[model samples]
Every structure is written in structure tokens, then in C-alpha cells.
Target chain A: MKGIRSVLYMHWRSVGSWVYIPWLILGSVFLINYGWRSFHQDSQSTNDVGNMVIFIYLFTVAWIFNGQLFAFASGLSIKRMHFVLGSVMAAILISIGSSLLLMLLIVVENMTNGWGIDWHTFSWKVTQTFAYWEQFAIYLLVFLCLILLGFFLSSIVIRFRKRGLLVFGVLLYVFFLVISNTSVNGFDHEEAFWTWIGQHGLLVFYSLIPAIILLLFGCYMLFMRRAIIRS
Target chain B: MHVKLSKVRKAYGKNVVLNDINMVLEKEKIYGLVGRNGAGKTTLLKIIAAQLFPSEGTVQVNEENPFENEAILSQLCFVKESQTYPDHFTVKDILLTAKATFPLWDETFCQALVARYNVPVKLRMRKLSRGMRSVVGVIIGLASRAPLTIFDEPYLGMDAVARQYFYDQLLADYADHPRTIILSTHLIDEVSELLEHVIVVKEGRILMQEDVETLRAGAVTVTGEKGKVAAFIQQQHVLSSQTLGNVTNVMIFGTISRQERLQAEAEGLSFSAVSLQKVMVHLTDQEKGSA
Candidate 1:
């Protein structure tokens, strides 16, 4: 607990350089998408602009594997447990911050009615179908789960270095082979998998939150406890 | 404030680096950790600082294991040569971060050091010149004021002038605030006078650990006529011997008292002290030749 406070404070500072890029890009996309299409007045043609969540999700993927912070904090004599705790706190904060930004974008979109061009970036299913509060909760959950996945991945990479990712890929490929090779009554496995996801996409993704949290937290603690300081 | 290591052995898979190293670092004394390029000096220092885990042995800092113990870790500061700050961090950012990490953080001292070193506070750490980057590390190590501060070649790219400034600052600061400081560096003679105790590590094994005075007393170079030098070193552990026609010089690891030196001087056997750096070289070379 003595070091935890310092670690928690370091979280925002650690990601300060990285937190703005995604939103800036999303904002540019919003402005440009409207500005370019405004002249054309293509309200009839659908604008397939990428979701802001794409950028938000990608931010964690890059931010999670920052080995420099580990070495930096270690040199400063931060305990491994404290570093991991701080990493979790950083992930939570980033996820919450990202959710808030998304909420702001949604509010702006609703106020401006898709920026007056019928653009739909943050106006996805969660914005239209769910209540405002539920929308924020869903956004928060999606962010937390995605960032948790990133954290778990970064932990694996740290524990094993470059070979860890290679090992993971191989194991995943082997698992896919095993799954695809398994067939019943001449039915295909890949087809069955996509059919399951198609029927229960929301249920499967929502249920995975607890599993991801449990696995990520447990594995990150175990691996990072013994993590070495790599140059 | 005392650190101890018992039968410490470190290896990566089968490539053993340190083996059977037993050492005791007493409190409030400046120690010089001297070794060759790959002689496990940095590894041993990291283990003591708990930035690294020892493969097989125990490292006790302040009579307690430093690993995962924030109370002990907070008491120590490890300034690595390759210590990295966040790429976006400016000098101020690094100083503030260091301040938060070290409980004994002295803002005034840090500010003074910043101005003394002439490091630009607005420039990002990654963009600074190599020497300036090292200056940042030096500033942090000095101002952190941890009870047990370990510097593993923290002045990697510093020039001679900056390095002298560091030595001067370090000596001045250590005099004002006594603490256990271990400086692991290749520049042995540059810091020979500042070191109270010297630990010479050769090929992962401690070649010797002695007080600086004792080390200076242990090895002496006897130069005189070839016959007299050879005769005097016949029963001594000769570290090196060279003959030049009618004259010979030999370095032996045995103390000659004042009377002995006076008698030897009567025979034209002039004596010169073997520096810690020269002793380290001869010791490491002997090991290499023997192996």
C-alpha cells in the first residue's frame, strides 16, 4: 500500500503521451468525413466510417506492451507487485476515460444529429438501441474487457519476451487445427463455430467479461511476479 | 543498512554467470565494485537492489530480503546505465517522477544539481545528448538520497569534465549525508580514492574484497636488479613479473613493512604502489591465462 499510491499516480503520467492520439484521429475523421461529404450532399449514400471504438481498442493494444515503464519503474525501486497493480489501475483509468470520451461523442452526435450530415461513427447500436446509462455501461464493459485482454497479452510477452508471442501463436494455430479437424456427421467445425457466434454474439461476448477478468488478473499476477527487467 | 549475499549463483539456463559468491556490504561505506566487461558486477548490483532476482542464493538488504518488500526497496535506489524514462518525459517530468519514488527526495538538491549540470529542463529525456542523459541519471541518484544507493555505470556516456564533476559532487554529498553507496564501474582508478572498500570480481567470482588501505598495502611492485627482484619475490605470490636485461620488476601480493622496505631500498629495490585498477587487470589476466 505504501508504494501503491505512487504507482497509481504514475498511471496517468505513464499514458499521457499516448491517450490523445486516438481521439485526435477520431475527431479528424469526424470533421473530415462531414467536411468532404458536406459538399457532395450524399445523404442518400451510406457513409461507412469506421467506429471510434476501433481507435480506442487499438490504443490499449499498443499501450499495454510498454516494456520501458517496467524497466523505468524497476530502476526507481518499484516492487513488481506494485507495478502490476499500477498497470491494472492504468488500464481501468484508460478504459473509463475512453468511455467518457465516447459518451461525449455520443452526446455531441445526438445534439448535432450526426453532425448534420447523417454520419454514424459513435452512433452505433449501443447508442441507438440502449438507454444512455446502459450505453455508457456497455462501452465501459467493452473497453475494460478489451484492455484486460491487452494487459494479459503484454504480461505474457514480458514473462517470455519475443518467444512468448510465437508460442501463443503456435498454440492457437494448433488449437484451431484441433477444432477444425473435429467433425460430426460430416458437418464442418468452422461453419459450426461461425453459426454459434452468429446466433449468440452478444451473449458470448458479454459472458466472456468475467472469464477475461479472471484469467487476465490471475495470469498477469503470476507471470509478472517473476518478471525480469529486460533491456 | 548492511547487505549480505551467501553462496550466490546466477545463470541464464546453463551459462553460469556468478557462482558461489559470498559478500557482505557494511553500512555507510562507499564500495567500489570492480570487474571486467562481463564479470557479473551489474548482475550482483541488480540483485542487491532487488531489480533482479538471484537464481540461487539469498540477498539480504538491511538484514531483510529486498524482493517485493517496499519498505526495503524504498530504502534503496538503483541507477542503471541504461535506465530509461518514458520517451515523452522531459527533464522536469523525470525529476518529479524520481521525487515521488524516493521518500528522502530533496527538491532543492535536485534543482541545484539540475542547474549545476546545465541540463535543459524543457528538452525530452530521449532527445538529450548521451552525456546529458547520463547526467539525468546522476542527478536522480544523488538527489534520491536513498539509504542504499547503487550506481551501475550510471555515467555511461559522460565526458571527462562531467565525470569529474560527478565524482566531486558525489564525494561532497557523501560527506554531508553518510549512506551505503556501491559504485560499479570500469573506471577503478578514477574512483580509487573515493572508495572506502573495494570488491574485485573476476569471472563472476570475487577475486578480493578488502579495505582500500589494505589493498594498497597488499600488492607492491618491487623494481631493482633482476637477481634481487627475483630473489625477493621467490616465496611471494607474484602477480606479474618482467625482466629488462639487467633490471627486473615484479608485482607481488604481500606486504613489506617499513623496515623491510628500508632494507630493500638499501639494495636499490624501489617500491611503487599497485593501483586497484592494475591489480584488477593482473588478477583477471591470471584467471584468463590459467583457464
Candidate 2:
């Protein structure tokens, strides 16, 4: 447990600056949206996808931190299991923090009527009917899922280098291509799949718990167990 | 701590880096791991440090497997020549992390070393010069005070004075706090005196492991008239021999008794001490010739 704490502390010390970049970007986007909405006097609620920026940034943070910190932790004689556990715990803490912040922002947005410009940045039009706690849970689960996916992908790259990323990219492209081709009655199958997810809402987010576990497991067993620092 | 490797072999794909490596490293001794580049010195050290796994066989640290064992890892520190730090990490950050990671970290000694080396604690690691980076590694290795500390060419771009100071500091600290230290370096002569035992590695295998005194006592260079030198070392294992005009110098590998030396000197064959560096060169050269 002490080893895990050390790893956690090291990670925070080294990459703590990265934690704020997403917020900075989100804040900038919010300002721009607010300015545009105020200037245009748009009363209709806008379904801005700007909030998705945080998720993308979180993914990037996870990918970079996993790749770099794994080598650094190994240099410190940290056990692989401890490093993995520390990373997971860090991700959980970040997710919880982000979820709470998003929840507060959503409450503020609702109370102020979308910052008085009818722009939905925190509370999307699709999920405004859900309770605040449920939204927080969804955000937490989504953050964890994306972060773990990033970790799993980064582990693949660390273990096999560029070739692994190339292979994974090709596989992902093929998967999307197959999904796009499997259309039914003129409706795009990929869009239909997302529509199903949108309809399920909380159920879809809740299902990510198993996926997060699987990604964490794959990261450890497939790449991290015998990983070595390669210059 | 006692470290034992039995039949340890490490291979990358079909390219074998280390093979049939079996050795015991006793506690509280400074052992020099001298070998040429690509001679598997780093691989062997990594195996012992638990940063890597051998393809076959076992490595026992204090009679326990060290892989993922926190109890063993906390007592070991391995400093590499090309040690990498996070790009944003300052020297102070690294020192703090090392202090937290190593159980026996000496912050006072670390600060003293930092002051002695004049390291810029606020500078990012990437902003530091090569020598400065090396100094950081040296400070961590020395201040960690680990039971089994291994330095694989920790002084890469350090100046001569700094290197000498590092040697002095290492020796002084070892005297004060006895622990096993393994120094792998190409500058054999510079560290020869600091080493208590020398482990000469050649082509992924240990050629010889002997005490410093025993190695020095066993090898000698006989210099005299060509015919006299040739006659004097007739039964000895000659590592190498050179002739210029009527003079000859032959490096003999086996021991020479006091009576034999006196007799040889009386016969006008003079002897000179062989530097550890020369011995290592000739030894590796001999291995290459045979191979």
C-alpha cells in the first residue's frame, strides 16, 4: 500500500499540470459559446457538444500518463501491480472529482437557465430529465471507461511499440466499416446503435462498469506484467 | 544482502543477450562489473535488480525471488547510464520521488551531494546537461543507501574531477555504511582501486570473478631480454606478449611464487605490475581471439 501511494504521489507530482488543461479548454469553449449566444440573443436551447471535450482530454491524459509513468515507475523499482493499482485509484479520484464538478455546473446551469442564453453546456438536452445524482454517476462511469480504454490502448503501444498501434488502428477501422455497412431499411446501423444507447441512457452508462474492469484486466495481463523500459 | 543467480539466461527473440550466468554476490563488498558494450552487463544487472526477468533459471535476492517483491525491491537501487525522467520533472522532484521510493534514502547526504555537484534543483530534467543528468543519477544512487546498489555506467558525461569526487564519496560512504555495491563501467582503471572484487564479463558470460588482490597477485608482466623472458615464462599461461628489438614483455596469467620471482629476477628477468585495465583489455582480447 505504501508502494502504491508512492506511485500515486509520483504520478501526481509529474503530471499534475495535465489535470487542468481539460478544464482550461472547456472554460474557453464555454466562454466562446456564451459570447456567441449572448450576441445572437438565441433563446432556443443549443445542444452544444463542447462538453465532450473533457472526455477526449481525459482519454489523452490517460494515454500519455500510462505510457510515460509506467517507465518512470519501473525505474523507481515499483512493482507492476502497485503501479496499475495506483493508476486505477488515481483515475477513480479524477472521475469522482470531475463528476462532482460537472454536477455543480449542471445545477448552476439549470438555476441560471443555461447562463441566461439558453445554451446547454453542462446539462445536455438528452439527459436534462435525469436526476443530478444519476447524471453524476453517468459522468463518472463514462470518465472511467474512457480513461481505462486509453490505458489499455497505451499499454498495447508500450508493449509492442508502433506496430501495435498500427494494428489496432486498422482493426478499429475495419470494425467501423463493417458496422457502417450493416444498415437496415435505409437507416445507418452505426447511428441506429447510438440511438439505442441514447434510449437506454443510465443503463448504457451502468454497463460500462464491466467494460472498465475488462479494460483494466487486459492492461495488466496482456502488457504490464512483463513490461520493460525500452529507450 | 546475498544475491545468487543460477543458470540465468536472457534472450530477446533469437538473439541471446546473456547465457549460462551463474554467480553469487556477497554482501558489503564493492564488485566491479566490467565488460565491453553489448556484453550483457546491463541485462544481467536488470535481472538482479528485478527490473527484468531471465528467460530461464532463477535469481535469488536474500534467498527470495525478487520479481514484484516489494520487500526485496525496496532494498535495491539500480542506476542506469541512460536513465530517463519525466520531461516535466525537476531535479528536486526526482530527488523527492527517490526519497519516497527507497527505504534508506538519506536526504542530508542527498542535499550534500547536490551542493557538491552544484546541480540546479529547479531546472527541468530535460533542460539539464548530460553531465548534470548523470550527477542526479549519482546522487540518487549514493543517497538511496540501498543494501544492493547497482550503478551501470552512472557517470556517462561527468568530468574527470566530478568522477573522482564520486569515487571518493562512494568509498567514504561505503566505509561508513557497509552495503553491497556493483559498479559496471568502462573506465576500469579509474575505479579499479575502489573495487574490492572484479567480475570480468565477456560475450554474455562471466569470464572470471576474483578478489582484487587475488587478481593482481595472479597476473604479472615480465619484461627482459627476449630470450630470458621467453625462458622465464615457459610454463606460465601467457595472456599476451610483445617484442621490440632485443626486449620482450609477456603478461603471465597464473600465479608466481616469491622463490620463482626471485630466481627469475636473479636471472635478469624484471617484472612489472599489471594495471587492472590492461588485464581486462588483454583478457577480453584473448577471449575474442579464441572465439
Candidate 3:
């Protein structure tokens, strides 16, 4: 119990020292919010603006938060499970809190000036909003996808030392090209992709299984492999 | 609580670092661990500290394996010369972390040593000079005061004044609260007066382990006429013999009896005790030349 607590304290102190980074992330989110409101205010497709805002928010957090979390875990003595749980908890709390405050502000603005943006369409694109279960399913899928992406990034980033960041960019571009060219699932068309996703939600669920397996396997190779212990 | 290493072997890839080493470290004594560079001194200390595992044999501390054993780890403090702490953290933060990690940490001693050394509390570790970094290691070792405290060449960068301060504080602290302190260093002469027992390692093996006074008493240098000194050194382990014309200086490893002393005096021989520094140099040099 004492060892566990000590590990927790150490992890908290280390991450807490990087509080400045999170604040910068939050500031970027606010800037995105203000920019979206102003730029789409006069557009004929103003209704589509909310959808874009949601996409930006989700993508930004997924990219920045996951990257910083991986770096934090690499440099600490804490266990991987503890780090994963702590980061998830902290991200959920901060994202939800910020979203709620922003939601309230949006509501007040709509009530006063009658702004009309399609919440259903925005939510549908960022997160499936057909049913609670379907929404949760889509969220899980996105999480697995991003985590696998993060795992791959972390593996290469940490393994290559100084030139890791540059190498990762090139590798990601190559990976993107490979997936685009292969089209192994015969869903090169958007209609086919969505139709397949809609008909066989189970298939979507099954796709996540492999992504999760790959993610965990990559994590083990990067962080827990005995050979990673440097003399 | 006693520690023992029996037939412990450690190898780095194709090169052997520690070969058939054996030693017993009793509790409540100040042990001086001495050896030259690449003599497996740090490797041996790391093995005992549980920072590195031996490739063969066993190292038992208080009848328990020290590696990953929190029960034993809590009682051990291994401070190295280049002990690392986070760069952004201040000295106070490092002290706090140490206090949190070591269950038996002494706050009073920590504060006293910080005050004695006049370390800057607010300064970040990266900004501190080399001597200050050594001071930090010294403070941690003293403040931890774990049942087993091992310091591996921690005073290398410290000046003479700071080194003296550390030695004085260490002795005073140990007198008031006794603990097993193992110090691995090349500065044998400076610390010979403070050590209770001396363990000399040569070529990855235990060359000699004996009480400091016993080791000092066991050797003497006899200088006289070349022929008489050469005859007198017969049947004795001669560490080294140098001849300049008729005068010869011979260092023999073994005590001179009263009769032997009388006989040497009658032959107009001058005798003196061998300094610990000279003995260590000769011992290491001989091992190297033999290899």
C-alpha cells in the first residue's frame, strides 16, 4: 500500500509540474471557439459551423492530450496502468468541465440572438448520436483508433531518440498512403463505408478488437519489454 | 543485520567485471571499500546495493534478497557520484521527494546538514555547481541513515573543505546513531583514519579484507644497506625493493617481530610503518603488472 501511494505521489508531482502545458491547450481551445463564432457568423452555411467546431475540438484534444500524456509516461517511474488511468480521468474531467461551460455560454448566446446550428448533425459526425449505446460504441471506436495512433507515435518517438519526431512524420505519411492504396475492405467509396458501418455495427465493433490488440501489443513492446531496460 | 556475498560473479558481455568475489559485511561498522578504476569496485558496490544483480551466486542482506524487495529497499540508501534528480526541481523538492520515499528519513538531520552545508533551497538542481551537487548527495546519504548506506565515489567533485565537512558530519552522525556505512573511494589516505575496516578489491576479486589497524600493522618498510636489506627481506613477501647505490628500501608485507626489529637495528636498518596510500598503490600496481 505504501509503495503504491508513493508511486501515485511521484506520478502526480511529475505531471503536475507540467500544468503550464495544459493551460496552453485550454487557451488554444478558447481561441478556436472564438474564431469559429466570428468566421461563420455571415456564412450561408452557418448552420454547418457547429459541426466544424465539434470536429476541431475533438481532433485538437485527441492530438495534443495524447501526445503529451505519452511523453509524460515515458519519463516517469510510475506504472503504465496508473499513468493510463490517471490521464484518462484527468482528461475526462477537464474536457467535460470545459465543454459544459462552453455549452452554457453557447446556450445563452442562442437564447439572446437566436443562433441556429444543427447540434444533431454536429454530434452525429463527432460522436454517433442515434442511440446512447451507438454513441458509446462510436466513442469507443474513436478512442481505440486514437490510442493505437498514439501508441505507434510513442513507439517510434521514444525508440529513435533525437531524430524521432522527424522520422515519425515521414512514417505517418507512408502509413497514410499504404492504407489509402490498399483499400482491403473494398470500401473506397464513402457510401459503401457508411452503409457497411450502418448495417453491421458488429463489424465496426470487431474492427476495434484488432486495433486494441495492436495498441496493447505495441505498448508492451515499447514500455514493458525487458530489452528496453537500459544498462 | 549482516550482509554476505559468496562466490558472486558479474560479467559485462564478454568481459568479466567481478570474478569469484566473496566478503561478509557485518553491521554497525564503517567499511572503506577501496580499489582503482575498472577494478570492479563500483560494480561490487552496486551488486551489494541491489542496484545491479549478480550474474551468479547470492547476495543476502538480513537474510532477504534486496532486489525489488521493498522491505529491504526501505533500509538501504545507495548514493552514487552522479546521482540524478529532475532538472526543474529545486533542492527543496528533491529533499521532499527523498523524505517521502525513505520511511526512516530524519528531518532534523536533513535540516541540520542543509544548514551546515549552506545549500540553496530555492535553486534548481540544474543551476547548482558540481560541488553543490555533491553536497546534495552527501545530505541525502546522511539524512536517510538507512540501516545500510552505501556511497560510491560521491565526493569526487567536492573541494577539500567540503569533503572535510562531510567526513566530520558523517562520523558525528554515526557516533550518535550507528548504521552500516560502506564508502567506495580512491581517496584512501584521506579517509584511512576514519575507516574501521578496509576492503581492497583488485582485478574484480577481493584482494584483502581486514581491520584497518591490523592492515596498517601488518606491513613495514625497512631501508638500509643494499646487501643487508636484500638479506633481511628474504623469506618475506616483498611488496617492492628499490636500490640506489648501497642504500636499499624494501617494503615487506608482514609484521616485524621484536627479535627481527632488534636484528634489523643492529644491522643499522631504519624502519617505518607503511602508509595506507602507498600500500594501496603497490597492491593495485602489482595486480596490474601480474595481469
Query: Which candidate number maximizes lDDT?
Result: 2
- Candidate 1 lDDT, tens digit per residue, A112-132? 877787665685653476677
* Chain A TM-score from candidate 2: 0.86
Backbone collision count in every prediction? Answer: 0, 0, 0
C-alpha lDDT of residue A23 in model 1: 68
Residue A202 displacement (Å), model 2: 2.5
| Superior by DockQ: candidate 1 or candidate 2 | 2
Q: Which stretches of candidate 3 lie over 4 Å from their true place?
A: A32-125, A128-231, B286-291
Query: DockQ numbers for every candidate?
Result: 0.65, 0.66, 0.17
Best candidate according to DockQ = 2
What is the overall TM-score of model 1 with all chains considered together? Answer: 0.92
**Model 3, global lDDT:** 0.67
Whole-model lDDT values for every prediction: 0.80, 0.86, 0.67
Residue pairs that clash (backbone atoms under 3 angstroms), model 2: none
Q: Candidate 3's error at A184, in angstroms? A: 2.1
Q: Write the per-residue lDDT of candidate 2 for residues B1-291, one digit (tens) a residue.
A: 899999999998999999999999999999999978888999999999888889999999999999989899888888998678877788988899889888899999999999999999999999999999999999999999999999999999999999999999999999999999999999999998899999988889998999999988888999999998988888987888899999998888887889999999998998888988888887877453242
TM-scores of all models? 0.92, 0.94, 0.75
Ranking by TM-score: 2, 1, 3
lDDT of 1 by residue, B1-291 (tens): 799999999999999899999999999999999888888898898888877788899999878999899899998888888787777778887787788889998899899989988999999888999889989999999998888989989888899988998999899999999999999988988998899999988888898889989888998899999988878877777888888899998888876778977988999899998887887788778454232
lDDT of 3 by residue, A57-129 (tens): 4444434443343432222222334344444444344434434444454445445443453222223333332
